[model samples]
Target: MYVLDTNIISELIRPRPNGGVVQWVDTQPLSSLYTTAVTKAEIYYGLHILPMGKQRGDLEQALHQFFSAGLQNRILEFNSTSAMEFAMIASYRRKAGIPISNADAQIAAICSQHGFQLVTRNVSDFAECGIEVMNPFTE
Candidate 1:
């Protein structure tokens, strides 16, 4: 299974998205892909912060398409297991001075807890978190 990061979701909605990401996603079954609650919240926060304009409109439209176009069922929530995983990862990172943000930790926790390979453009941020990560933007 694959868990999509926020940036990857943004790429999918772009008019000219990253070709590597597009191709990789196209070849995979939709059921194998998922978006975590962390990612969803980030996307929504981004859209909401944009000024009222065409850019915002476009982003909003793309976001709607993302949810409505058969990707809705894959949104993973922050359940008890996810929370426990988050606590563990967050505590470890803090003790190790890794300085990982809460959102990224939550996303990584969900992915790790579920044994999902994370798909993201920000590959380095998730390194050493004990989960497989694939950078679709890479060659």
Candidate 2:
């Protein structure tokens, strides 16, 4: 199974999304793709901060429909197992002087707990998180 990171989700909603990313997503079974609550929060936060306008309105509608239709049952939560994974992963990275944002760590934790590969554009951010990561934008 693959968990989509925020960047992948964001790209899918773009008016002219990357062809590579779109192609990659199209080849996967819908049931095999998932997103985390952390990604939801990130997407929502981005939409919330945008100034009210046609762009925002369009994106809001697109995301609403996408989540409701495409990912209703595929949204993963950061449960107890994820939290423990976060603590371990975050602490290890911190001690090693690696700077990973809390959100990325949380997403990584969810992926780790579920044994899911992460689909993201920001591959380096997740490099040492002990989860398989694929950059659909590039490969």
Candidate 3:
């Protein structure tokens, strides 16, 4: 299975017509894709700028369309174990001097723990953390 990084989900929610990554995802088999809690948080963070009156409604509609229909059953939810793994990855990267966002670290840890190929645009960052990455735009 493939775990989608934050940007990939962002593109799906607020689509970029030229986003090759999103297009590539469409070619994958059913149940082959997945999203982590980190991704969901990132998407929600992006949408936080929306007016308060519309935020909830907009987010609900977007999520329903983006996940229910777009990703189907591949939307993986994070559990307590996943959080522990994320903390581990964060510490490892911190000691290694490879600075990265907490969300990215969490996603990477989830992918590592679950043995899922990470679909991301930032390959170098994840590579330094030793997580396998696939750049759909270039692939």
TM-scores of the candidates are 0.94, 0.98, 0.80
| RMSD over all Cα atoms, model 2 | 0.7
Q: Rank the candidates by lDDT, best first.
A: 2, 1, 3
Q: List the residue pairs that clash in candidate 1.
A: none
Compared with the true structure, the alpha-carbon lDDT of candidate 2 equals 0.94
lDDT of 3 by residue, 1-139 (tens): 8988876776666634446865797789857888876787777676776777765677668876876786776666667777787788888878888778877877887887788999877788785655679988689
Q: Give the TM-score of candidate 2.
A: 0.98
What TM-score, to 2 decimals, does candidate 1 have?
0.94
Clashes of 2: 0
Clashing pairs in 2: none
| Per-candidate local distance difference test | 0.89, 0.94, 0.76
lDDT of 2 by residue, 7-115 (tens): 9999999989999999999999999999999999999999999999999999999999989999989999999989999998899999989978999999999999999
Query: Could you give the candidate ranking by TM-score, starting with the highest?
Result: 2, 1, 3
Best by TM-score: 2
Q: List the residue pairs that clash in candidate 3.
A: none
Two-way TM-score contest, 2 vs 3, winner: 2
Please write out the lDDT profile of model 1 over residues 66-108, one tens digit for every residue: 8877587899888899889988888887788887899999999
Query: Looking at candidate 1, what is the lDDT of residue 11?
Result: 86
